[model samples]
Target: MKTKFSFLTLLFIVSSFVIAQDIQELKIDSKVNDVTVFLDGAQVTRKKTVDVPTGITNIVFVNLSPYIDSKSIQVKVKGKVMVQSVSQQRNYMNNQPDLAEAEKLHAEIFELRKQLKLAQTYLTITRKELDFLNDNRIISGRNNELSITNLKETSAFYGERLKALKLKEIKQEDDINQLEKKIQQLENQRNQLSDNRGFPTGEIVIKIESKTNSKSEFELSYLVTNAGWFPSYDIRAKNISEPVEILYKANVHQDTKVDWENVKIRFSSSDPNVSGVMPSLNPYYISYNYRPSNYGRIISEVSGFIYDNKGEPLPGASVSVEGTTIGTVADINGHYSLMLPAGSNRLKISFIGYSSKTVDANQPLINIALNESAQELGEVSFRDVEATSISDALQGRIAGLDISRSRNKKNIADKESIAVPFVQTENQTTVEFEISVPYSLKSDKKTYAVEMVDYSLPANYQYFCIPKVDKDAFLLANITDWSKYNFLEGEANIFFEETYIGKTILDVRNAGDTLQVSLGRDKNVVVQRELLKDKTSRQFIGTKKEVSRAWEINVKNNKSQKISMVILDQVPVSKNEEIEIEIKDLSGAKMNNDTGELKWEFELNPAKEKTFNLNYLVKYPKSRTLYIE
Candidate 1:
């Protein structure tokens, strides 16, 4: 019985050893480096497949990047397999087999050292023999020579011996020098390896249990520091009559030491590196009657309801005192309460798909309205451009746009609610873009333009010329319900009538529901501004000075098409209370007295011209000299 037990124990030990040795290493491939990097952090996923035996298995991935966040390591298995445990540890001892080349170099160094020592020993021996021959010179040390023949023979023999010893020493020294040079090269290689590794190798160890013996594929994903991506876009418009094209792109950068090759990539707008859980909110009771010793330090609580422009209740609206963390969300009835410090009367309210609103909190029943965000853009489409550069496209395209599967799905609930069964919805907090084409990104930091979404929408075109500042007419496209398009503040490239006009900025930060994009200057509409010196004069009346000026503007439509146009000019404004100003002549133009702005809107037929005049008078004390135009 004892012998049988020993045999069984031996078998079990062998099996365990075999199981531990059954490790499979996978190579990272199909990497999407165009990551959707949030304000902070990046994520990378790698997919690999390996055939595993039907039982317990230990998989060891070696030589991974050291910058990997161990806590972010995740292992997913496909097929009938169960993951047991996943762990990551640093290998300071440099156990990676791939470094065998470095080890081989070190071995060569060792051999070279041995050879160098041998050569050195030989060199020393040759030097010693040369020294002995020189010290024991027959002609200098001893006086035993009698005849000239004997002296010459003895001298020749010693001379030959000295020459041979010198040659031998030279050969040994040359060999030693060559060996030392080779050793130096090996040491340099080792130093480079240390620099590349930074410290030691990082290895990820995964243990899995298989229910049945079948081939399975595994995907290993982890978050790595020093790798992230940012959002970039390209907007192009062929003409004001056509819809604008916006290409959403990502600029990804990484120095994690791992190359993510042509793999499936997903960009996340939300940062995984940030805290996922909301901060704990402790209970607080409002005490209106209690004030701190200093009245200035008194605090207060304000509650209010949030509504939309149509007077509809807005649930989930976030209300907080401006610049303070104290806040709350509106309930189903759009009612919210917030505790604020004294003198903080400012309140800020925000909701998804709506413009944020800020108002004073002086009224307890503060009712506010939040305008809806930009309207959803049209389907992605493309247009041709004479300029082929990405930078040129971004500079020329229309600034806002999107079309996605999420937008196509009807009855899609708010991203905050629970998802319906058998339905897949995108996360509201993050934006996902799947490029239709295959793209590659490098570890080096650089921006590559990828086509994201194209949009087609109706545009209302109008010609506007500010003759006061510029003589050229600029085409403007007024797009209503612009809030429906999910446009962020970015640059736009403008093209008019298949021509590359110029570039402008699409600033949605403070835009209203209507978006006005300016196309480049149009020289076809000629404008001329001339000062009428004959109609200008200055006079002094009873210690007071009166200055008068007059100007004329002429606009000519030189294009074949009849166009509606607006001409803008300004009158001088005075700040001194003692000065009196008057608009002597406006030619029926609309004038803003507060701003001293004059605007004329009219339709001009082809090959037709219109003229307008502006005259202003300024009166000030004659005692004080003043410059007026």
Candidate 2:
């Protein structure tokens, strides 16, 4: 029950990508038994409570059943809690503090431990530097101990430089108590700016049988924090086999004596009659926030990332982005990396306002903050990016996005139907998607032609569907009951780069007589053109982005063979960096310049739309004009 490891700097202000016309699976998490779930797997309610009412959005954190077993039912996400705790001023161990000065010393020692004489000298100097940083960083061996491997990289670089100079002397003693709270906010803005009307929010009617307040039933729910008082409720235990024992009783105003720890559980604060006992009430609010407990004041902010109207990436939002900076952190889920002025361009996101966004500097990703502004009077929670999500319904009617499992299969969606590129050799070329049938469901070489047995596919990875090829069986079993078949419309011209990584399909069953199909809604989508076109706009050709070579495509009958496409392109190595590729198409008809491979015969003519002819090279740095979507 130690659980006192904080460096609090969490800000999170990225929410604006919510399009789930249907088919969900977007993964999200926040455990330790507390709760922050968001799976994108499908159907979910219990958002607990979320409301900022206004500006900024760009959320994402999907893991929904990555085909299960990503480590036993693994779908972990929620990565942008920014600055959790980082305090120290044993003299700012030489100043360098960050993590919002460790979440402003975990929100100032949990609000000066209820004013224990303004924090009994800050819990006696964080219990004497948590007992000499837990005895030289957790019992000798400091920095989480363990060494001996030719000086384990010089004892883990001087044990992480003595835990980063003892967390920059606990963030220079919380930036000298935030420069004494910026000198008491410049002496309250030079005295007399009285707006002390503060108290506004209020709502408390939860009774869950009073959580055993003389009755029974020990389940609960009631949340809201900071700006209000009365320990926030957080009793979490979502169906854990069994084991739900809670018996907290509070009453410690007879004169202080508290102490409570976390991580599993522990309590101690006796006083029920001075002779001892009365300080273990940790009712549960766990935002811990260890604010710049000691050192704080780093600087930098221009923030970005906020989308959700089907653009995704909005984990937590409550930003400022104005004049420069004020507060915020969460973004991994909503995508943000702000520190400002590394090149500073522009940013704004405003909350409690309902209509205040501004973003710039070439879209660092704000996916969809198109709200317009209106509804935001007050309490009515749960709007965690309700614009529309599910990865924005396969972005533009499924041009390509395979990572399925979301028909309520419980999350792991985003870019569903996509299977057309696996072309193994014979000079690789592509233009796939085949399944036409309709001659009375064809099947009969007269003499009762029957014999389609061939199994072995527990799970080889590639599982999207529509592989009914059998121009007399090139390896697909012939046709038994692998789901009747049908799914071939117009395989986009050629633009395959669904992020390959060892890809595995295994030539349609056994390649001797194939017949296996999966996806059917008559899909084929198609829409992709410039795979490098002529080259212009400042043309340096590329500073990087021309690697390409990972091809695969199939279609036994409507034919269009030879595949090795990776074409992708991008340049600019610095000045905001850029580098992406997998190219090699020599000249549409054939050539494998070592491995950027590309061979063709191209034909799959089901609906229409086709074009092929490739070349590669890009390294620009000077002239600019990049407009992408």
Candidate 3:
């Protein structure tokens, strides 16, 4: 009885093991590869179901993307199943040509080679027979009488057999060539199919335990690399009086070795490559310093380089001061220098194969590049200045306009535009726009623009001029509530009254509530300044000299509409107390005494003319020579 019971127990255990030994395949393909991407990696997930018995079982999930990080794989099972082990591996053989098809090609090639061997064997045998006939001297035999007729009959018999043998050999050669070519063609087709196998498909194996007979759903996730996105923008303003429309957009791209195929997407403005360590703060200190003052005035010396459009130096280029005979030619390195008169602010540069360029000499170092002129001449020039760009052109023009990224998590946009949703999120360290709609992007470097935000803001237009530096007047558009819109610094094309004026950089990073942009210069208002040489005089008293100067300015409004304008000029400021200066006449102009700046603001009617005068006197010691401009 004891032996029978023990045997029965062992038999029961065996039966249970046999029943639980059932292995099921849960083929799960990666369904989501377009998850929010980090700087270092991307997020991906997959799901499937596997039936489990009331015991331990192995579940194999196939067709996973090869780009998945094997080490990052995590498996979760529902329905009272405990995952024992989760692993990932690649199977290139599975993605190769079908085994039966490959075998068929191999068989055909083998058969052809066998046939070729037979043909070669037959050819050797025929050649040997022909050699035997040649050596046997068939024209006559040792013990046989020879006759001309018998010889002819014997020769005819051997010749006919030789011709048949040669024909057979030729046919075999042709057959071999055809067979080889056919085999080669089949092999090439197989090779082409292999090449199109695409990314190596991988599989995930999961060992799980179930307490009772049950079915479980498996959720798998892994991280991948080579995916991210960038932002672009479009800004439009119909008229100077109307509000500006700003359309924010995003350009996303990915090459994770898998097709997303309408998978929902979430974008994050984060870089996973950044360290997650907490930052430490240290104490700060400040100090002050003092120095002696130098009363000497700095001479205005301008230096610059002349380069071609390709950034190569034009050694023989000519650089000259505008309206003056003073000039210099560039050296071998395209460097030149000239002492500028106090009132002169422009320089002209010219090269043989390039168009001449005029640049402001206000800065100490002025670098000018010339563009190659077209061969054709006498083309009509356009009067209206076209805007350089119609949208965001402020890129690289301002500081602190960079959008930051996070290492983990993406904020999804709440607002949807035409079924494409946009999510905006902000922090002290980063700002992000999360798009929920699926965006298709390939590994190719082509750019795709997606609209993110649209904004309309009020703006005011004004005409301003600084005649002391530039003679032309510029149109300025002042916008308040600029801070309300989260704008990045970029290039903007300006248009006024339905006409494109020019392009200007829109830098809202440093602007607080109000932002001002300069449209191109206006030509309707004309301004001129003339020196009154007849009223100028100089005299010497003892060892001191007194110099007196006078100037007149004329401004005219040529437009049909009345306009207000601001005119700016300046009198020389003295760094030395020994130099005595006095303002004699200002013609009721506003003066900033500390800066010696003069300003005039007034409205002029259509086709109206206005005049103003400025007079000043400078007295200094005659013993020391003075430079006046």
Candidate 4:
């Protein structure tokens, strides 16, 4: 019986040892192979190949971004292995790598502090020595009688010693001041660098079960924050006779704390952060509206970007309405929006190291640049204000503004040489551009411009002018079938006739079948509007008033070729039944009765000019005052 018990014990021990050996923990390194960057976040795909033994195993992937969403974790294993479960956890032990420049600056600041301390100590000691010399300066007359030569020598020694100590004290103080300034500069630099570092990493652990020992390939993917892309464009037109060439590009940025080296990039217009489920409509209940009323009309909101003199975004800048408490701060992207009270027409902008500026708030979009200030101000604290949503701020708020994406085109003659580096794919609700070449994107917050594609489309160009509003003529290009090119609303750099003109916004979201793009002001086309003083008159007839006004507008085409031009002018419409307005002469112009706007279209040859006349008469009660311009 004793021998049988010993054999069973030995068998049990061997089986337990084999089971423990089969289940092993393996740490594997993975490389970021592909990245799909969205408008708000990015999806990272990593791959690795490894050999595994039979049985259960835990594969650990380390050094990932701590901002990764755990629920988005996905693991796939190819070969004879079956993925049992995948999990992720924060790895505080493995922090992000320290920035080399920041570390060097820190060392330099430490050394400078030590030198400043020494200089301060030396200055204090020198001052003490000067005091000691002054206290003993009376020794010559008080203690004993001395020869004239001895008295002169002692006086000279004291004068020379005091002067030397004073100079030394001045030198030490200067040195200390310089060291402090140097330390401050270095600290600022270090602070900027340190902002991008010290984030803890993450680790993903996958449990796998394999039937037989074999080589396995694994793919892991997850969504990470602090990464996104925005679109920008370049619109070029060599001349009015040719088509407009549009260059589409994207500004990609990421701060995932992991460098994406030689990885394939795909820009997706879809925002995975937004919910995919369709919204359901609830039953509506009717109710009476009761609200307080203000006297003047109030602008709902105003939104725009705040930039520094160098065109860089000034985040955390303060923007407030003049003479009111309504205000908000810029976001991390330098975007701000404020709700204006009644009759607020000016905006006050301020920053710590930049000069404050006050600008007119008459427009919906107000972008301002603040210059750097010589004197630094104390830190300003901002309240945590909830920003208005993009949809809420844009819907029916900004007239004629739309959002979409677009592609660019090179010159028509160089169409063969133009190589598109991306393939466009359309999904149900979004579009994606898959880049062909691999990209190496570092873990920095700076933007990388990625050129997508170029396009040259047929356009109808015409010159448009509103002489009453602006004397300069603006060139407009009407592009038919613009919807085929997926376009997003963004800032566009405009170039006409081989010269860089300026910048404009390309908004196609609210466009119809035809898209009209402004090519900026053309100085060659001169326009002048004059009011005829002899035709202006006002008279009263027994509590009734009659006013007559006449204006003349002249347009001259100075270009070497014939051009099409459209001129626009407006007349005031009566708001009260007691007032009446009549147009005597519009110079054969088309008029909109509802808006009282006149439009004239014509073609002019080089060095040719055209003139138009507008005459109007207004009749109103003489008791009420009326203003017209």
What residue runs in model 2 are displaced by over 4 Å at the alpha carbon? 1-33, 37-202, 206-214, 222-629
| Tens-digit per-residue lDDT, 47-120, candidate 3 | 66666776666676676555555555666566887666666666666666676877787787788788778877
TM-score of each: 0.49, 0.19, 0.47, 0.69
Instruction: List lDDT for all candidates, in order.
Output: 0.63, 0.27, 0.63, 0.76
lDDT of 2 at 186: 46
By summed lDDT, the worst window of 10 consecutive residues in model 2 runs over: 251-260
Off by over 4 Å in 1: 1-41, 47-221, 225-256, 268-427, 436-446, 574-576, 625-629
| TM accuracy, model 4 | 0.69
Candidate number that wins on TM-score, 1 or 2: 1
Candidate 4 regions off by >4 Å?
Answer: 1-23, 96-108, 118-178, 185-197, 275-420
Error of 3 at 552 (Å): 5.0
Of the pair 2 and 3, which is ahead by TM-score? 3
Q: After superposition, how far is residue 608 of candidate 4 from its true place, in Å?
A: 2.0
What lDDT does model 4 reach?
Answer: 0.76
Of the pair 2 and 3, which is ahead by lDDT? 3
Cα lDDT tens digits, model 2, 1-629, are 23332222121211222322221221222112211111000111112222111222212222111111111111111222111111111111222334454456556554644443443455456557656644664334435644566456766765776676567557656755765665455444432222111112211111010111121111111221110000001111111122211111110000000111111110011111112344675554446665433223233333346654556444443343323222233344654444333333455553221355665544443443635343222222211222232222212232321222222211111121211111111101111111111011111001011111112222111112212121121111123332222111111111122221121111122223343321111123232333343342223444432232222333322223221112222222223445333244434444444443344434344344445544333333334444431
How far off is residue 481 in model 1, in Å?
A: 3.5
